[model samples]
Target: DTFTEDQICQVQEIHVGKPRIVATIVPKGSPFKKMMIYG
Candidate 1:
């Protein structure tokens, strides 16, 4: 099955409604590693 860009975006809009907390992951040698925090 194949989905167009519009179709994929629509699905994401429904599922990714709200984000409580966001975390940025970086490489081990990078400045910031896997750091998680509350919302």
Candidate 2:
């Protein structure tokens, strides 16, 4: 997926402050997507 420059920059900035902000995918199709935070 292509993200805008600003969006990418924002994500980078967020990573600088908190380097663990990524989504965790679970097995099978579900309605809930888990978000794992590890700083």
lDDT winner: 1
User: Model 2 lDDT vs. the true structure?
Assistant: 0.56
Each candidate's number of clashing pairs is 0, 0
- Which stretch of 10 consecutive residues in model 1 shows the poorest summed lDDT? 30-39
Provide TM-scores for the models: 0.28, 0.28
Q: For model 2, how does the per-residue alpha-carbon lDDT over 1-39 read when each residue is reduced to its tens digit?
A: 899998877774343464666666666554443332322
> Model 2, stretches more than 4 Å misplaced?
13-39
Cα lDDT tens digits, model 1, 1-39, are 999998887774365566678657666665444232222
Positional deviation of residue 30's Cα in model 2 after best superposition, in angstroms? 49
Q: How well does model 1 score by local distance difference test?
A: 0.60
lDDT of each: 0.60, 0.56
